[model samples]
Target chain A: MPEYTFLVVEDSPTMRQLISFALKRIPGSTIVEAGDGIDALKKLSNQKFDVILTDINMPLMDGLKLVSMVRNDPTYKDIPVIVITTEGADDARERGISLGANAYVSKPIQTQDLLNTVNEIIKSKA
Target chain B: MAKDSDSLSKKVENFLKVFKKGEEFTQELLQENEKLRYRLAQQEEVSKSSGRGEALNEQALEERLKTLEDENKSLLDRYHQVEEENKDFANRYIEVETENNNLANLYVASYQLHSTLDFNESLKIVLEIVMNLIGAEEFSIMMLDEKTNELSIVAQEGMGQDARKSIKMGSGIIGQVAKTGDAFYRDGDPTNLKGIDYTHPLVTIPLKIKEHVIGIIVIYKLLIQKTEFSNVDYELFSMLAGHAATALFSSKLYSQSERKLTTIQSFLDLLKEK
Candidate 1:
């Protein structure tokens, strides 16, 4: 089955739930939530996801470090890591690239852009 | 007459060697008679007139001759000293110029080695060249493995298999370069790089693309040289890292494109069958 599986790495439960709800509105989709990189890694070891949406700031591990860890790992390196945060700065973008993040989306994201971008990357990545 | 004869006799005694070997003795002997006659008249006048001006002229001539002789001696001494100094200077300049040429050659060679395509080949060539050029007895190029995603010694020089196998990224100078994406140097550090004696000055350059923290290039020069890692090393290693990235990216892309083309062809075949 050509189903869309998304792994959302966010520290906030409310934001996670909110994003999950919005993502569910899209057809042919399933959602998995991880609180941090460590959690994300645990889930990643078990199953593969179509996209890895991560947050910049987290307790156990931040999004940038997670992306680097993912990119460094041969198994998970190819997965696209989109950094979701309230920050948008040159340094942040440069840092994200260095850490091997695929792309970036600002926080308080509009549900429409998120859905559209997710679809596009999954489509292109596929 | 006797007084004049005695003075002339002393003059001849002083210059006996000068006249002894010379020719034309008959003409000089006739000249001496005229000089004696002049001296007889001059001495008579010296007793009569003040004769001070004539004495003064003679004294002036003697003083001038003394000064000229002293100046000639001084010039001879100076000539010898300058000759010695020029020789010393030439030797020193040759030594410095030779060293500079050697360093320039090494820099060019290192740059060429850094330009190579294969990672292991580049590392092996770089470490060996650095060891030879910089006289680093112990050397390694620890890289972050693309597959394992961990810093590992993919290629190393001047080491046994076990020694090479033990080096990992984030562990020593090489590892720190991979971890921090910056160069560091520690001379006989408080905490040494394990296994390798802390007997050399370690030069580490972070193999980074922007801030990727890819790996480290270490040049372990002798311990006593007081040579520290510089922007120069970072600049060189970073250039090598840039080349490494192109090689890596090209290989990755080539494989991916090859696979994509294969997949698309297979799909097309299925469509044709249908």
Candidate 2:
């Protein structure tokens, strides 16, 4: 798998670190942090990351808008966007998937399961 | 007949000359040798069996049986040791159960006191109860500050200023509950005095009345990693939070009612004077 930079866009600092903790458990990872969707875009403008791990609710710009923008961009269009959220209903999940998110993870995440899915998604892209 | 016997004995002697001297045991085992010839040679069958060769075999068999008996005895001793260990373990389990039951009774009594409306007094009582029940190395409650939009330590037990101040809303694991109104954990580093480590398997509960979040009730290091909060702990805390919420809300209404009662009494006196 190509070397990846996991950008965790979460407003809650605790959740940000939690997701970061789970991601860092993966071997040889480089993580980029963002407080919200706008912060994430600023980081994206500076450089490209392998996969984007975003939360649905954020200040400034929400995750749905971010996904739309990322998909529209010719340069970063192919990048897979995975939306991590607390909402588990079909409609909520369909909203994220329709917005071009490659995957969705429910809140109070299962650490090992997330890692396994992440590995598979990244490997498939290769 | 004597001549014939002498001739046969010379032939036998000549054959026996081929046998080695120390091969007596082999000669004794030979089918061709008869007791009658042995009697003529002044040896008896009874004496051969009862003498050196049989005695040596019997001695070796007894030694083998003696070692087997020793082995069996050692196994029997080990079995008794294991039985004693099992009994000790059972006794320990019973002791633990007794202690756990005692703590549970105490927990129920303490939680009953939480059914009072005065938030400050109620919280103080709750803190005292928690301190008395599960003693941690340190404990503190952080609530999200609406104005500051940060977390501040409101109540504390067994913690230093540095450890308490080391925490902030939206900064550490404790801050998650304050910010998101969701109960969560934060991993602590030994070097820094943070709220308990997230990995430490502590429990956090956000106090809510209806949909509004008031604060969180946290039990920290009630037990070490080896022991997680029991079902009793979870049930105990849940009941405590519920009672606390109802009391707090009722207290809020009671205070509000006092204000309105005074306002109405003053207005009635003004009307009487007019």
Candidate 3:
């Protein structure tokens, strides 16, 4: 299998770390971290990513807007986008998905579920 | 005739065997067709039911997601409100702390003002209080001599030699305050120092002994960090006005009494020797 690169966008450092830790389960996977949607966009423009995992609520630019921008952009539209959100964020999740988020994982995210979802999306794309 | 009967029976037997075989084959094919048709119907039903179930599930998920999003929004709003409240509390805490600190400073200033009986030491304490607590960098304490009607500098800080050493009573703002026995706060005006070589006077507190004005404390300039005097500084000035004069006056009387007592005691001893 080819090496996979993932972009993790979350405002909370701890949440970002947890997601990064779980992404490490995939062999030969590289992870990039961003503090918020704006930072994620900067990183997105600068590099290539196989998948983008983001939180719904973030400062300076939310995950929904990021998803819209990614989907609208020709270069990054096909990239698999995942949303991570709290349990009560149904509306935000819906917006995220409608804007072209491929999947959403609710908190507290089970490591296996996260891995399964990510792997399935990557496999389907592959 | 017997041979002819045998051949007809054989032909009839052959026809019966072929008819029976054809009927059995037709029955088997119909049963197989019916089983295949039933299986196909079941598969179609399963697929239709599953498609309906998936739609229902997606609808349920959408509803659930909506509810969760509302709850999340509510929680975030509450979190922001709590953060605002915390910030307000922190600001209030700082204000209260500063007020307490100012009160503490005033108490310390009053204590230092009356801690000594020596006139010079008392004057030094007053200067120290003004410089340290009142945040004045340039100032002086001047005593009024009733005999000459003149005010002379007793204690001074942060002034050039060209600064005024004496001011006759009834002359300038300083004289007006001394004559009227009223304290003056100039608010650190540069206009007041336009023609004067002396440093600017921000405030002048009159020191009173009973109803009489005994001296004046002139605050020439405030420290660089302090922009202006507050109400608390005025409160301190009022406290110094009464207590400072009493301390100085009583200490002068005490020394005079001690000297007179010593002379009388020595004279009595000489009489006892006689």
- lDDT tens string, model 1, A1-126? 478888999876545655665577556789999998899999999997888998877888888888888999999888888877553345766788778877776544445557777877878887
Q: After superposition, how far is residue B7 of candidate 1 from its true place, in Å?
A: 61
TM-scores of the candidates are 0.38, 0.37, 0.49
DockQ for the candidates, in order: 0.01, 0.01, 0.01
Give the chain B TM-score achieved by candidate 3.
Answer: 0.68
lDDT of 2 by residue, A1-126 (tens): 457788888775545655676677566678898998889989998887878998887889988889999999898888888888653345656788998999987654445556777787788887
lDDT of each: 0.60, 0.60, 0.75
Cα lDDT of model 2 by residue, B237-266, tens digit: 666456555655566567778889999999
lDDT of 2 at B131: 42
Winner on DockQ (1 vs 3): 3
Which runs of model 2 end up more than 4 angstroms from their true locations?
B1-274
Off by over 4 Å in 1: A1-126, B1-58, B73-92, B114-120, B145-149, B160-173, B188-201, B219-274
Ranking by TM-score: 3, 1, 2
Segments in model 3 whose C-alpha atoms lie over 4 Å from true places: A1-126, B1-50, B188-196, B209-211, B223-227, B230-232
| The 10-residue segment with the lowest total lDDT in model 3 chain B | B188-197
lDDT of 3 by residue, A1-126 (tens): 689999999875545665776787677899999999999999999999999999888899988899999999999999999998655558988888889899998765545668889999999999
On residues B9-95, what C-alpha lDDT tens digit does candidate 3 reach at each position?
455455555545555554564555556456556655675777765556455555655665565556556555655655565565545
Please say which candidate is ahead in lDDT: 2 or 3: 3
